[model samples]
Target chain A: MREDRHVVSVRDIPETLDDSALIGHSLSEPETFAALFDRHADEIHRYAARRLGPELAEDVTAEVFLVAFRGRARYDRSWPDARPWLYGIATRVVSQHRRAERRRTHALSRMSVDRPATFDDRSADRVTAEQLQPRLARALTRLSAAERDLLLLVAWADLTYEDAALALGVPVGTVRSRLHRLRAKVRRALGGNDPFAEEPQHG
Target chain B: MDDEIRQFAEGRPPAPAYRPEARARARELLLAEARGGGRFRLPRFGWQAVAAFGVTVALVGGVAAALSGRPQEHLAAAAGATQSAAVAEPPAGDLEPRPGQFILVESDTMYGSMTMGRNGEESRHLYRTHRKIWQSVDGSADGLLLIEGREPRPWPGQRELPKDAEGRQSSLWTTLAACPGAPHRSDYTYLSTLPTDPAALRERLYTAADEKDVDRDERAFGAAGDLVRETYLPKAQRDALFEAVKGIPGTQVAEGVEDSAGRKGVALGRTAGGTLTQLIFDPATHMFLGERQTVVDERAGQAPEGSVVALTAQLKVSVADRLPDEAATAEPGGGCPSSAVPPTEQPTPAATLSPPENVTEGPEPAVTGTMTATPAAPPAVKRSPSESAPAVPESGVAATETVPAPPVAPTETAPEPAAPGAGS
Candidate 1:
């Protein structure tokens, strides 16, 4: 058992390297970049899927890694985690399909109003949230492309304000202010229900 | 801390499960770029970007070819040819354009267009367009491309027309500059200078530079298609082109293939990556019709197998004395910077020999036929494995004895340096 553990540890060494270190090594050994893909492709795909839909998520995921691999030389080595940089490229790629995004949001805003009534076991709070979906989707369609990008980068991608700002190539202050305005607008659209007023109550 | 904004995640349409094939293909493309040992340049223009999209789809189907160092040998071993024995005499044409005359080509085309949403959802459709181009014979003056968008059709499995594609029927025109040092590739004078012998022409076709990330055989096949598609080739050159295509290792014949214009014709096709590009020819007359590309294998995040991703139908090819007056009033700087005109001469204003109305009213020629014949015996050329096994009627009248030797070493011919910003 101890001998097997030693062998496993040795094999796991390359996988343990930070993105910055892996990127640095990839300059000399291009295959090392595959580690980055393996590490982040799923999360990136999920985030893109949430934004664009599954069909386009595949392309977005592929394009993000390709763009990242090609631009690895210019990757800021100081940033240990590559998530922000990857998200930044994803943001740009998603922006190119603005029309499709608008259409998606518009479609969501039109989801049937009686949908919540169909499910009996759902929690009251969950039901309320479901009902707000139409308003929320409509509100999303109204946001500027940049605002929508920052909102989704935070809400969907789970990026911090700082990381979201990095992904967007904006100062942290901009992220804060824009997010603040976006929350207020969303709150108004939800009829004064402050989405950030309380911690999320459900998983 | 998470906010109610996270609630939007619940509203997201369920994303399709990530396919491992997509991941592998993307990784391979990156590794290939890395192995190429340079900064990867994304295609810069709209059409080139579309071509790149198709290439990505093709790569998904062509993993075996991509992995091999010798793509030509692998492809040659895999490709087969079926030749029909009924030879047709080459069509007669006095296609040579006089000095100052423009070689006008009008065609209808439909190509795949993909758009991804901010949410990561994408829609695929075929964007259709009608194009009219006027090129100077000697590359001494400006050329014009008058393109009008047509209705778009959804790809297979797509239910509704993409919202963004709605109301895209707009007419736009671009000028092809004929400046010194940057000749239009299809300039008649240069095309007329090409060798008319099949063997020599085949060598020239093989020696042309490979398109970025495309294999030598694929590039040669595409070059052959480009030479005949929109440009007028005199009888000798056209005859040689058909014969030269036979020598290309992967060239296959498909019987009863219909072009975009609904004209049934015999097709000579080649597969690269995952796409099958067929250059359709009139079966009886063996006249060039047009070209179409079909997806032969399942592509990642793209059209399904058997989808016609690209299609073109040549409507007319004629000579015009001058470009329309609209060419004179077109926006400045709209012309391609790569003009073919000499530095010493000022460009003469386009002479108004005919009205624009007259130019647009030319009757469409009918080239309709039911191409049903198949030869009982294959030609004497070497054969390999092919996707289309149907035997085609012999179209080209070239002698069967002169099959050129297999493609020579790529190092033998230097790739012609591409002119900057040249439109494909």
Candidate 2:
């Protein structure tokens, strides 16, 4: 037990020390750990901003990677891709700051009218993306927090509902239903009979 | 629905990385905690205690993949199999396809545990116990139901329910018809949406039904436990469950696979967690078969996965007996209870103020060190002798005996005695 305590101690360093050994180095190596943060900080920052807005985004992003690094000891080594795990943590962090998130989204929607194209600046190949911002924001506000989270994670993060479920820690069934309800609501809001406007429409 | 909304939000590419210096500081903070020298420590769980918790109900039942766009025929087959396993034999060709789809459902059945000890018994025993039934109808849900087994009687802590005319329990139909999205009507017109508060939303549904002078909200309130509990789970946990299932190792859309219902559907890949989740749908109707979630939690740093948690169920769009009521098509004026009616019809927005009034006031104000506020305290302190003694040490110690009033009058009636060494 004494030896085990020392071993655990070496594994449990603070932010001042480097714990990143990638399975085979002295846990004291800080440079190894810096590589992980350098890789994820900015993308996580952008994701935080997109979900929570610019002001709260930076802090939330920092907190996210900070958490990820702290919890890295518990990570399953068999899993190589860390994006899903990071996303899962980010989802909760975003939720904790929900009020801030809502206010930001509301503000963004209001501004979307001026820069409608920026929200969905898909290539000129698609005409609908250009014209849909005002109507989309209105539709966006009608959705429940859960609904909006599921939708936006997919659009911006490009995660499938299944991947999203992992990021969200929810069953896929919930994801599908939220999407369905949200799509229906948006269609009703927009009065857009264009089948493609809704999800999984059979043309 | 979630997928559709997400598709619309299409995210941008990753942002540029932060400079190396910032990354180094963050690395140090995490390592300190890792070394156990910082403020954080990982929570400890006894291996036996973990085993005793049984499989997490949600993790086990989440084996059912939430399906989309499946044939009705396949759904009937799969649902029939699952139901038959739990209950009686299912109906034949009851597997026939139908319209609409299964939106979502609660995945797990959580059983509460209890430890009982005899008066003189040295050892207490814990047992696996059953509570309520919860299932999600579709992938986007957490617990499909909030309540289980028999209508709950009202209690001190009981949540309020909506009721119908004749003082009966109300349902989804009666409440939604006249309410115009009563729960969320406010944001709806501007964004055309509904409110998210379950209680407020319930009231809106009730108000809509009451427009006909009916008491739907009241009736629903009576049976609310059944309505909401039918899908109860903490909102945050539910969200987490969605994220977890999505992260299961190796989860991907399979081109062609047969689900429990034997429907030809796309497969979702597995995850490192060893949970297999897939979506099966009918090409013809786009109806959904419930999800199949297979979960395994391998012992950390151990070679073998320890246990298997499997939960599967089916969700279909069934005709709710209570629907086609006013909630489906609430025409104007059909439900306005006399008191609630006037404000609703005039096209003016009705103010739905429903917060409790008796918010408690805070404790007496703390004293600030300002000289201007000192005079006000003396009079208040003097009136209450008991308080003044402890409050004003300077004045109390100076006056040994009771003192008379210090009066200065231009037209003097009498010379007031200076009590307690006043003359000295």
DockQ for each candidate? 0.12, 0.07
Please give each candidate's TM-score.
0.43, 0.31
> Considering summed lDDT, which 10 consecutive residues are worst modelled in model 2 chain B?
B46-55
- Model 1 chain A weakest lDDT span, ten residues long: A1-10
lDDT of 2 at B385: 14
Give the residue spans of candidate 2 off by over 4 A: A1-31, A115-134, A193-203, B1-3, B11-424
lDDT of 1 at B154: 74
Candidate 2 per-residue lDDT, tens place, B271-358, comes to 3324343433323222233334343444321122422222223322221101122323432111211122234343311221111122
TM-score of chain B of each: 0.58, 0.23
